[model samples]
Target: MPRPYLLFTQHGWADTNQSMMALATALTAKDEAQIMAPCLDYAMTWLRIAPLIDQVETLATATLAQQPELPLRIVGHSMGGLIWLEVLNRHPDWWDRVDFLVLVASPVGGADLGRILDPLKVGLGVAADLGKDRRPLAGRIAAAINTLTIAGDIDGGSDGTITVESTRVPNAQFVYLPGLSHAAMRCHPQVIEHIQDFWAGKRLSEPLIPHPLVNRLRQIPGMTDAHLRDFARSTPWHTFTDGTSIHLWRSPFGIDHVFLASAQGDCLYAGYVGWLHGEDLRRSLDALRGEPELLEKPIL
Candidate 1:
């Protein structure tokens, strides 16, 4: 007989554990699973995230101690996903026990709105913590665990809050559900369906193969992904040989924002760099100009 599931469902900032609790029940209705859905203090969520992570870790550790052999299946929404990433990062020993991980509308690339609220990186309530980019840590965890990321795109690129781009990470399966808002994602039926598919070892969609230009842009120092809500204001600059293109937009404060678009006019990436990495961004763009394969090509 297969080992029973050791399941965990975590709620995000300013959220009660009720939604996740319902999610947990739905996910394991037919299976023999032990579920742990901790109700974090809603008021405390407005502060830092470290204390919250510690709280969850303590509960998880004690639960594992009792049944150390059961394979783990975790589901996290928004901040909940970030917490699990931190927990998994601190305990590599627990990596093997994690069978599956699902991040529902989590911002793995950092929350763009959070950066706006705390531009100076000050500990402005929970903004600074929410704005942190945890992709590197997520990448480390994904290498060892079977990971799936579910993002809702109510607009062209965002789920009314989290951008689809921000939810992406390397080496993980991605499911993009159009027309779904952020709050609706918590216990959406489609979200549940996709998670069930993932648990059954099914591919929800084709693996995302990022454009080569995206890979190059990511290597630039201090480059951070941004939301596409402001993409309409940007001006087209250059189009590459592969029909990929670049657009430019400068904030009133002189901050540079860059965007990547496909030949089909679909937005592929939106990112920005602060003054510290301005020079790096320029040099990277200049280098791209010299490469014929990535050079400007007129849109026909």
Candidate 2:
């Protein structure tokens, strides 16, 4: 069983519950923990920022009211942590209520690229306004909880998007994985130990695994070497002609949610999809590239 914590999982960009389910299974091995992963879209998507902020506040308030006895702990992956930070910024009082906050391969400050492209998104109207204001959001959240942050040095200082400098908060405990990629560090056994130790309020003695490439993957948009390491555990081939098949394996490439459309073709959608087929679609997305692969998989 996992520890008796709220176990709120914040996934990366475009991710739904697909990635969270795998994490919940691993973290709750002891069975003592109950995890709740909500359906969250990209923070920049889904209308304006106020509504998005309200979404988390509403959920957190409900969770706090219902599970008063259970220690509330939050774990966010990538942009998911960014959303969590947004929530905390709105309601700082909730920070004291939380036990521990564990951010896996999360870009706390801001993704280096985010700084560059964010303007384009806002300018071209591709995404909602996500400015430097989000950077301070994480710092505010850290003030509320016993925050623990993990960053990968594989790509300078990014899990892939947010830079390490972006993730730095004034008082939060920080750990830098010199060689692990942003996403790969999520599956590293050392990451598990750090998460568990923080939950138990213990300090980590040594990293479980300190493989390099953590920061190296920052060079690419969706190619995290950490995915290469973690990929073997689920499926060797991620790109598949069939979207459903791709979801069977954990996706190494970054997407919001993994999904396979009902369309009849030798292709699997790579981007975002609902539950069930999330893992199934990621299994077959090994061949395609960029956003096109996100929604439609090509036949091999």
Candidate 3:
């Protein structure tokens, strides 16, 4: 029997294979293909895209060698998208290997926020890559293969991290989603649907979720913070994503209160910052049904 299509997913800055796994789980549900996700390190004092791309190139080359006849589909987010642009540009032969490509809120233009820290040189590598006028391979990418660009927008503007303008690529089809953020784009149900549809040859149009519910998604940064929670809504509510939701809030008085709740409002990861809560936190996470990494990881 022929092998299933090989789906590869690359994650953005500071994120891990965990986030991409959720999408992979959904995409491979029909036994259509096996998915692999590679992670990049954007930790403090160390950040560079070249090495990251190199790793992907190596992976792609090796994967294709093992299964030369299998169809390939790639999905990249933020920096991950930038990495693939270079991968295909550098390895022109991979063109035939790829059956479909998807870029989710990737910042084809470049992320302006990176400039805010340019002086520190801490994240300049990524900042320059995300700039709108900074991407050189963008046009080449669109020319070689049909690519879909997905941009997320919260109510105010931008996907909380990436601006719609930054996500745009010349000569490429663009889909703008309301009530979605950069992080949310990686795991949002609607976002996933659009990507799956695109893979199935559907034009990227139609908004997945309503504007009102979009406002309440936990994809927004600081959604769990005391200040942001109080500001965003008057009534207490859980985030839109499934699994156990945990938010560590620090009071003005310096007391840290950890709030944990299920998608149905059941407490899952709650604790006081004082002591002996690590084990309790881990125990709670053990019962999580969907994407626990979304709850455990710090939301930047």
Among these predicted structures, which one has the highest lDDT?
1
User: Model 1 RMSD to the real structure?
Assistant: 4.1
Clashes of each: 0, 53, 6
Q: Positional deviation of 58 in candidate 2, in angstroms?
A: 2.6
- TM-score computed on alpha carbons, candidate 3: 0.63
Off by over 4 Å in 1: 219-223, 229-234, 239-243, 250-255, 263-265, 273-284, 287-300
TM-score (all chains, Cα) for each model = 0.88, 0.58, 0.63
lDDT of 1: 0.87
RMSD of each candidate? Answer: 4.1, 16.3, 15.9
lDDT of each: 0.87, 0.54, 0.62
Model 2, runs deviating above 4 Å: 1-3, 42-51, 120-137, 204-300
**Model 2 over residues 1-300: C-alpha lDDT tens digits?**
444667787665655667666776787787577677877666454344455557777887898889887778788876667677777777776677788887776555444354345433454221333323353455556665788888776644345544554454545777777777766664577777678777777764332211111121121232211222222234323333433333224344533233222224222222222233345434433323334543343221
What is the per-residue lDDT of model 3 for residues 199-298, given as tens digits with 9 covering 90 to 100?
7778775322212222222222212112122222222333535443445554565434445455665433222322233454344334332443454454
- Candidate 2 has an lDDT of 0.54
Can you write out model 1's per-residue Cα lDDT over 98-138, one digit (the tens) per residue? 99999999998888788778778879998888888898688
Query: Which should have the higher TM-score, number 1 or number 3?
Result: 1
